[model samples]
Target: MTSNSTTYEGGCTCRQVRYRMTAKPLFVHCCHCRWCQRETGTAFALNAMIEADRVELLSGEPEPVMTPSASGRGQKIWRCPTCRIAVWSNYGSAGDAVRFVRVGSLDEPDRLPPDIHIFTSSKQPWVVLPEGAPAVTEYYDTKKTWPAESLARREALRAKRS
Candidate 1:
């Protein structure tokens, strides 16, 4: 767990937009799905999942671009207008309540490592996962994988939905 004083700052490539994370991410995911590869133009997409309330804008506003996803509901990618760098995404499941932050956009990308690797069935053969890291062929059950606090937080969100 990150200390309360520990904050993360990040911005777009052109530095047109800036944001801050007040707390540690609830979880980080290294997704190797084909859709992720096509969107990121890379082997995988490293995303740090956090509540939208935790992300505070410090500078320029990012534009949300709707993009197709494997889930069919699509996702809204928040990107810097000038640099066109994707800072984060809001999936349909949680809408804007949660943000899937692009870890690569972080000032200290190495600070938060992937808590789990998903969609490994389609992963490139050469990309090796770290030993002992939690990995699965597809998405895992949140009840079985997510931390207790995260589950509780999700429950609270669900309660609000109802």
Candidate 2:
């Protein structure tokens, strides 16, 4: 949430796969959906959303593994081939244009905390969201929640598709 550097570096558990983000993330999500719980083997998943183009591989290449998701279309999780640690994922909605980077995979994960908590309808009963934190029962409208700069960036990307 608070960092002096625009760029951030991270990699797999073994440190074999390294990558850098050229810019700060557009947004961060604390997802509590059942699918996320199952995939992460935890109560929730912390993901930093950003444009895929901004992610640069500094060392090892990640293998994109096809995986099932709440959406039938599925997603591709880019993981370190050797350590098998998932670094990021490309969902069906944005394809490869956007990446949901696993904050846990970051060297300084604390630098980017969840901007919003999503899919709380299916969240575990034991889990309690922070007081006054932005949360929603399901996915949010990016136009309403995303920062102005991020919204403009997204709009520009959409314009290119047209």
Candidate 3:
């Protein structure tokens, strides 16, 4: 919305759902939590945290499927009806205002690397975090980890949330 040029386009595996991130994300998270590993069937889940309003739908709509989370607060996973591939999710804390876009679903996932690695305590033994990459045993306080610009963006989004 602020004349951002870094846009990312992506979609589901079946191409049933297409979307574009209008601006850079607030922050990216590479979660190694057990829930993430189980849900993604992989070692981790890379998510680009962004304001929901910044995500523009380009094609089909994604159906929101309510799913259980480790916090027991539940999460709404938005997936393509045709492929059933999750594109993003709305967590209970963020409500429907924020979206955790699956980085793997992006057309150029490598363009947005994880800003931080979370829940590393549950990370797979075979996966060794890069030397210098920010890794935390659990979640982190955004005030301490995120950049000032990102924190400001988050604050703006927070005002918009109901």
lDDT of 3 by residue, 1-162 (tens): 123358998999999899999889999999999999988899999999999989999999999999899999999999999999999999998888899999999988888999999999999999988899999999999999999988998888777663
Q: lDDT of candidate 2 vs native?
A: 0.91
Question: Could you estimate the TM-score for every candidate?
Answer: 0.94, 0.95, 0.95
C-alpha RMSD of each candidate structure in angstroms: 2.1, 2.0, 2.5
Decoy 2 TM-score against native = 0.95
For residues 58-135, could you state the per-residue lDDT of candidate 1 as single tens digits?
A: 999999999999889999999999989999999998788889999999988999899999999999999999899999
- Colliding pairs, model 3: none
Candidate 3: where are CA atoms >4 Å away? 1-5
Candidate 1: list runs displaced more than 4 Å.
1-5
**Per-structure clash totals for the candidates:** 0, 1, 0
| Cα RMSD for predicted model 3 | 2.5
Quick one: ranking by lDDT, best first? Answer: 3, 1, 2
